[model samples]
Target chain A: MPKTLEIRKLHVEIEGREIIKGVDLTVSTGEIHAIMGPNGSGKSTLSYSILGHPDYAVTQGEVLFDGENVLDMKPDERAAKGLFLAFQYPVEVPGVTLASFLRTAVNSIRKKQARWGGQPLKEISAIEFYKRLEEKMNLLQMDPSFAQRYLNEGFSGGEKKRAEILQMAMLGPSIAILDETDSGLDIDALRIVSDGVNALYGPDVGLLVITHYQRILRYVQPQFVHVLVDGRIALSGGPELAEQLEEHGYDWVKDQLGESAVTRQNG
Target chain B: MANALNFNRREGYLEKYGFHDKNSYVYRTEKGVSSRIVEEISGLKGEPEWMRNFRLRSYGIFEKKSMPGWGADLSGLRFDDLYYYVKPSDKKGRNWDEVPEKVKLTFERLGIPEAERKYLAGVEAQYDSESVYSSLKGIWEKLGVIFCSTDEALKKYPDIVRQYFGTVIPPGDNKFAALNSAVWSGGSFIYVPAGVKVEIPLQAYFRINAESAGQFERTLIIAEPGSFVHYVEGCTAPVYSTNSLHSAVVEIVVKEGARVRYTSIQNWSDNVYNLVTKRAFAYKDATMEWLDGNLGSKVTMKYPSIYLMEKGARGEVLSIAYAGNGQHQDAGGKAVHIAPYTSSRIVSKSISKGTGRSSYRGLVHVRKGAHHVKSKVRCDALLLDDRARSDTYPVMEINEDEVDIGHEATVSKVGDEQLFYLTSRGLTEEEATAVIVSGFIEPIVKQLPMEYAIELNRLIELEMEGSVG
Candidate 1:
């Protein structure tokens, strides 16, 4: 069976205020799907809800990963099921070197996989880990010194994005959700980070690129593009849809969906 | 992930080190302190007449003094219901095989002998009120280095022992210091001759096996001119229902051009009140460093101090504290610059979980005529929950015009975003919090020895087991 993630009629609310109101999407291995929407259009909320953030309560909906309901799973459990989310703003954890953090994460996911009748991932030795980490860092164009620094601490915008992609490469997730990863980057940094993401794309992983603009889409092409308006996918089409939305803003989608779209978008 | 995600039911994590055996004491003093108890302790040791008179005078001062009015609350302490001294064995053993069976079993469980065989150049094990086992490597003995019990040192090297015993920390220093002066025993006394350096660390392990017992050990280390020595002390006590008291006075003297480093890790059980006074004096061109870690104890009030008494002297203190469930850790450092060109640095990290509280109370003083002195103090505290609390009280008194002083403090709660980031990477909530905490204290933990650094991290993880939801 192929790996897949299906979000059905997802309704999410944080602090009693519904943000993601009735959203549906599906992604499969070896496919790339981009969800484009304006700011506050629930794109990030959908991504966070998929990852099982405790604050984002699923009021009414179900999320399935590989045909199993992941709605009740914890964040780490969701991660163990080969689900990854690239946060818009990565958290800074001081005192923990990047090398140690990545090692723990890799070992944790390996343990989870071993429990599911998969081949046990042997604990990587320090030399092997350093070699692999160096290879990944080189591919991502990150400095070697980053392995000793605290995770995401005192990092620039481009460094953080590259670090996120570096983790994606190390974890080898089946499905990855990139939430507004292109928001805070210059053109040069945007190109480097997009290239790093593109390098990790293969037949074993599916990608869900969530962004408001089509800038990152130019570097890393998406197979399918969906216009998210009023917490719902109002229009869906090929990669040209992203260029159309970029040229004609979100007003075109709101116009096509009439008064209800405008009311829900503002609401 | 069977054992990987076993954070929810940490049934035996913290209690692994809390095992204790039945009390079997050879000699025990009556409850509380007085001139009679002091005289009895002095007479038992058969000390010199002047030493007996000194104890009597110190006892008078202790009787007149009062409990401190600041830091942790000690109002619940019952002085009348505690034994001042309890000897576990009749005599000190020069070898591990000669030690008593029960006491030897306790040390074996604590891994003292293993550690001694591995890296320590000298080892001293203090059970209750006296050193039960003590030994020094032959190489150090050939180098004119003296490592023995304080009582033995007072008898063999009386001139050197009496010269610097109370000079660094006088008997009238504070209430706990006065109490320690009157009835102190069992602590390590080390002396390094001029131009001699001990390569490996000297270790002392203190254990309180009896219930409601007070272990007052007095340690004095003297590094002669151009000498070097590193002394490490570790402490732990078995779990007891009733409270116990641990009041110690450690005085170190670093002579001209000498260097000394003192590292201590105190992990007394929650039923112990750890009130200690430790200070060092650095003469011209000398250096002193103190690495202190406080993980256990119901309430602890200890602030290691350094007095830079001459030009070109330096001092440093790196301290870390962890307070869990019903524990209060009030620990910090102090530095006083009394001469020109003296420098000092102090860094402190603390974590408070459950309903525990941690406070950093430090002082830095630059006395008059002390010119071109530089000092910096940094304190960081992490609270695991909303109920946990932390406080920082730093005082800087600079009386000179050409001195430089700096201080920085931060108190933070574990962020939800940080937890989410770590959990998203497949780490459990408890593991994520532990990672964050270890990172927070990495600056100070890195300064510890390899074995101790690992143990400190493990202890912090055990304390952080149920801290996350």
Candidate 2:
């Protein structure tokens, strides 16, 4: 059976404020879902809540990835379970290099992949890992010198986003979330980044592409599109919904469900 | 080695070299610090009128000052019994071959003169109370730079000493500073001329081969306008049954548009009271950097400070300390901005293992006249086991509104999984913890010179031995 991520009525809270309230999401292989939202609409919160960031408390829901309870797993364990979230503003870890960090994360995912197989993967050699990394860098037009530099230390916005996709490519996660990957990129950088995402969109990997614009979706086509207003998915439909919503704007949904009423009902 | 073993069974490691044996030396002081001992120390060093009067005035200040209650415990320090001075054999050795066999063996054990011959651009090796050998290479002297003991500077550059000494940090600044001024001996005196940058670092190694004796060294470094230099100070005291005292003072004056980097790696015997005062003054467009490492001491109270006195000046202090059983490492940094547009940063990393305690007490003060000054302070402490403890106390007094300041502190231990992961990769428990500790201290290690960084790693490994099963 093809592995899938089923989020059945998941609600998340930090302190007392609800961020992801009753969010129902299903992501399957060979499909890319584009989630568009206004600012402070809890779009990033949902990504963090799913990846098991310690701050977000899962109030009353079950996130089932391959039929396993994901809330009970640690962050690294969730990462090991083929779940990757490319942070919007990637943190700079001073002493940890991209190559060393990727080596550890890749080997961790390899260990997870070995349990169900008849034979172990015998941990990829350093040379093999370097070869794959070099190839992925070329696809994204990323400088190979970045692999030795400290992770995201003094990188520009476009460079950081490219590095994030590079990680997704090297680790080969089953389900990956790219949060605001096109926030601060120029038109040329936007095309290069979309191509990198398109190259990785295959039957083996499912993607949740989160952004606030409809421009990136034009390049990397999504099979499903959802508009997040407040904390709930107020409008969800096929790929055409993105173009409609982008043209007509989010007020139509806000008016259909009264402004404060829909906000309180979902927020 | 025979004389070492036969010297005294009670004194550990560097047994025979200690000055505690009453009959071991000639022309020593009686019990306490009165006018008599002060005069004895001065008269023994061969009296000059101005130097004698300077020590007398400092002795009065040391008497009036009381012990500070802030940092390390000073209750165990027996000021009356500590031998103020030991000649360490009669005369200073003019050459390497002339040094006495006992003192020579002590340097051999420490690998001192050999290290100087290889890596250091210049060297000063101080044994007990005086500089036994100081042969700075000709490359430095040819540049019109002064690299010699404080005593030499006192005689050769008296006017230079009179103009700058106690100007940045006077004798009355603190208790330890007053004590150091009273009986200071055998430390570096450097003066780099304007616009002359020294590529190779100058270094001094102070080894206390004598027991129960106080070695009070004073280091003074002055970089003229637009010049640069890096000075390193290292200390290691031989173990003893009774405690010894090492109260040194280091004062640096970086002139306008100059820079000076001072690095220290301290590994004293657990019975020694490692109390020292260090301060630097940076003028307009100048910079000062301090890289301090504290490994062994019963009670150490040191905070290397910088006073930014002009606009566009910079200061940085990078320190790492490892405290094991029966030790307390109370150290931090202080930066005071007296002018506008000055900036500073303090990054301290400490590891407390096996009932040891490490605390980071620091301050970033900006005066009202100092506007638009920016500073950031980050302190990280790693406690190894249940018995260890760590604390961070940061105080920032910002009088100006146009400034940026950030402070962060993290306290973590060796996670079970981080250790398990390493051991599963075919390393032993010791090797795994060694790697983690090395990684923990990587930020500071990367800033050190190549040879010193490797030596520090090996030293940390040696300290970790027998710490775990």
Candidate 3:
């Protein structure tokens, strides 16, 4: 089941600079949450912190992915636990093909689960896997030929995001974090990627969409919208908050919680 | 303790690669190379004007060159005691059954026959001085692709052989290159036609079947314009009471829009000195990739390198080495960007155990005119035992300001967490170590042709068997 991805007093530091400071948010199963803010508002850091990115260290706080603290786990471990972070800039692993990488990542999760005293896993053969992968690629509107290509190598902006969604579809993680996947996308590609995410969105999977604009939010409606400013949640409301923030800009939140006050709250 | 030690020792890649019995070589030259033997080898190989001239010219270069003062020390090399060229057997055989008993028995243990039956487009089995089996069947040979021994290439296709043999790596390039050129014998010579892509991999296996011998091989691979070829070399030397020398020179040329992947998995014995030189050149829009693995040997100095000669060209080197006991593997890569928009990468991984020493020495150079050139170099080393040593010396000569270059290296031991993760999965100490070691070298291993890759995995596992604490 898609348990709530709850962040409580979450503090994170990237390269010794405290980025995500005292942030609190909750998204239930079947709910879509969006975090929007300015350039240095720690939106991406929050997503990275929750997914246990090696750079973003959780100095003090807890991210509960299904009531279990994710800080103690490695990035791959968190990923295996159905915690997915669609990177703002997906890494390019040149030699590993998309198929082999996904297969290995999935199999690693299965193998890790086997190590965790979980039930044994039976992996599908390549023939069966290719059929399913082709379907997922079609669902994501990805060209089928990309399946054999190297993971994210020389991929366009839209294709990289689609590949990320394809990985999410294959892994079928419980909580999906899309970190600015909407950036550099033509509206058509934005719709296709958002639709792909929406198609993956069900009661069993929760969604956390971080964006610089509400363009993607228009396609995938969010039940919860939080304004992240200066590393903390400055404003929290329903999807209407996104519309309001988009219209008024983060200026409304900036007025209430200025720079000094924000740092003080962080401290 | 005796029973435990036996079990541990049986678990290493050493046994798989070291299964051959020691045999006394017919003859050996002095410790270092010289000019007289160059004439002797030319006379022995039976005589050709151009061939003899190349050797004599290369011998001149060798005489003029000095031993390299960097990387691994070659002070202990006894060139006269090394059999420069040893054809202990009669002639090159085309089948396994026809091969000499010693050569056949050696590869039988290394699983060459099985790999030939299953994977491999063609297998060139070279035991010490010459190939015992060189076979490329119907469509492959019909494709106008010449996949044969270097000696055969010199005799059969002299024009192609003389044209690009020393272009990428000339005899005067380095001391070892000159040495290899003077008395080079068994090695691969592949020429894929333009627009031809060899789907299956072509492999060459080199074995040091003699004690106190030297293997000087010159491999020339030319992937013509728009063509592609993946050539792999697997080597293993038998344990000898005395030291030996395995010096090789490999030159690969990737013509315009062509691609060439060269992979090597070398695990020589503890007494062998493996000093090899490998270099490749990539033209406009071409790509060259080198995947080299170094395991055994008392001391080794090898750098499988590439030169991006034209614009929009790319070069990459992924290398992994494991040094155990009295071994010292000094291996890395080099990349030179001569034209605009050239990209290159150098990744080196190594593990040192027992009293072994491993070092990653590399250079990445971008010429003044090379604009928009991108390069990244990463070297990581792991020490498995207390007395083990690992070092990295990387030199980046960047004359171009428009290029982007990044270099990072890490040196550490096997982490307790990684071992615990594998051990907790029900693997014993050796199994856990084997898994982690293979994973550490997975980047380079993945590039090998599947059969050789599996054999390499097995060989590494065998080598690490008794190594764990």
Candidate 4:
């Protein structure tokens, strides 16, 4: 059976304000989906809620991973269950080297897998772990020095995004939600990050590329595109939907959904 | 989910250093302190007349002085209930084999013998209130280096002991110092001759096993002109329902152009009150460094001090204090510059979790004629939860105009975003908090030796277990 993430009628709130109102989505392995929306359309809220962020409250929803409810799980448990979310802004964890952090995450996931009933796997040795990390960094076109540098501390915007991609490559998640990974990247960086993401896409992994523009989709094309407006998906179509949104901007979706439906109180 | 920050369980410490051996001492003075008790202790050691008189005088001063009014609360300290002196053995063991079976087994459990074999140049294992075992490399001894217990030094090197004993920190310096002066025993007494550099660190391990015991060990290090030495000390005690007292006085004399580094990793059990006084004097062109790491103790009030007594002297202090669950660590460093062209740096890092509290109490003083002096003080604290607390009280007394001084302090609670980020990468909550804390203190940890650095990080991880709800 394929790995599946089923988000059904997910009503999410942040500090008592409804952001994701009755949104329903499902993603499975080997498929690509893009969630596009304007600033307050609840695109980020949806991604955070799916990953079990504490600040994002799911008021009335059931997030099922492979048919099991995941809303009650901690963020770490969600990650252990093969879910990954690339943040819009990766936090700087000073003094913890990138290589050490990635190794720890890898070992933790490995231990969780052993507990969840696969072959009882041993932890990756430092030498072997570093060798694999170097390979991933090389594929991402990242500087090898980054392995010794503190995680995202004083890193450039493009470097941070590439590090997020590197982490995804190392974790080998079944489902990865890239939240605005292309937001702060330059054209060259977007190409490298897109190439890294494209490499990770295969029959064993799923990609949910959340972006505001079609620039990243131009390189790493998604099979499905959903235009989110006012905490709800207003349109779902092929990859051309993203091209239409970029060509006409989010106003076209708002116009299609009607002014009253798209006009939120803050907006 | 609402209460994310909860108290940390200390069963790790209880398993690691909380086991007590049976009290098998050769002798112990009656409980409480008096001039007669002090005289009895000195007579037991068979000290010279002047030294016995010094102990009596110190007892008088300890009687006159009062408990410290500032820093962590010391009202819980019951001096009258504590045994003033405990002799674990009649004489010091010259080797590990000569040490009593029970005492040697305790040090073996603590890994003291293995450490001495691997990297230490000398080892002093003090059980209860006496030195049970001592060993120094023959190479160091051939270079006129003397590494022995303070009691042995008073007998073999009486002239040198009388010259420098209490010279740096006098008997009447403070209440705890006065008490240590009166009932001090079993601490390291080291001497390095001129131009000799004992490359490897000399280590001392102090252990307190008896209940309501007062272990007052006095350590004195004299680095002759152009000589260098690094001395490391570690301490632990068994957990008891009633509290114990560990008040030590350490004084170092760095002569002209000499350098000395003293590193102490104090891990007394939570039932111990670790109030210690440590000070040093750096002569012309000399250097002194104090690395103090405190991870255990119910209440600790220690501020290692350094006095730049001559031109071109330098001093540096790097301290780490971890306060977890009912522990209060009041630790920092002080630098007094009385000579020109002196420089000093003090960096303090602390972590507080549960109901624990940590405070950085420091002072930097530059006298009127001490021109061209420089100093810097940086204190950083990490609180794992809202209930944990940290305080910084820095004093700067600069009467000299031609001096450069700087002080910086930062207090940060482990942010929810940071924790979530680490957890999102698959680390558990406790592991995430430990990672953040280890990162916070990495600067000071990096300054320690390889083995010590690893041990410190491991100790921090143990303390961080079950810190989050």
- Give the per-residue Cα lDDT of candidate 2 at B62: 89
Clashing pairs in 4: none
Clashes of each: 1, 3, 15, 0
lDDT of 3 by residue, B1-469 (tens): 1232233332343443342223424444544456777778788778588778888899899888998878887788766676676654332223444434544444454555553421121112433223333334355777988877787777899899989878888889887788888888878889999999988677664222221123777788999999998877764323322337888888899999999998777767677788898989899999999998887788989888888999989999999888887789999999988898999999999988888899999999999899999999999887887899999989999998998899999886666544432332223456556655665676777767676777777767656666786
Q: What tens digits encode model 1's per-residue C-alpha lDDT throughout B1-469?
A: 3343433212343444332323435687888888899999898888998888888888888888988989998987887888776665533223544434544443343444454321121112433223332234566789998887788789999998888878888889998898889998778889999999988887664222221223788999999999999988874323232337889899999999999999998777677889999999999999999999997788999999999999999999988988888889999999999999999999999999888899999999999999999999999999998999999999999999999899999999998889988999999898899899999999888888777777677667755666678
- Candidate 1 lDDT over A1-267, as tens digits, reads 579999999899999998988888999989999999988888988999899888999999889999999998889889989999998999899889988999989888777777775786677778888899999999878889988889999988877887888888888899999988898999988988888888888888899999989999998889999988768888889999998888888997787679766789999
Candidate 2 on B354-398: residue-level lDDT in tens? Answer: 878999989999999898898999999987777889988899999
Instruction: Show the colliding residue pairs in model 2.
Output: B18-B210, B18-B211, B19-B211
What stretches of model 4 exceed 4 Å from their correct place? A118-121, A259-267, B1-18, B90-136, B205-214, B235-243
For each candidate, the DockQ is 0.79, 0.04, 0.03, 0.77
Q: After superposition, how far is residue A44 of candidate 1 from its true place, in Å?
A: 1.5
Runs with alpha carbons beyond 4 Å of true place in candidate 1: A115-122, A186-188, A259-267, B1-19, B90-136, B205-214, B235-243
* Candidates sorted by lDDT, best first: 4, 1, 2, 3
Model 4 quality (TM-score): 0.91
Per-prediction TM-score = 0.89, 0.61, 0.59, 0.91
Over all chains combined, what TM-score does candidate 3 have?
0.59
Q: A-chain TM-score per prediction?
A: 0.94, 0.93, 0.93, 0.95
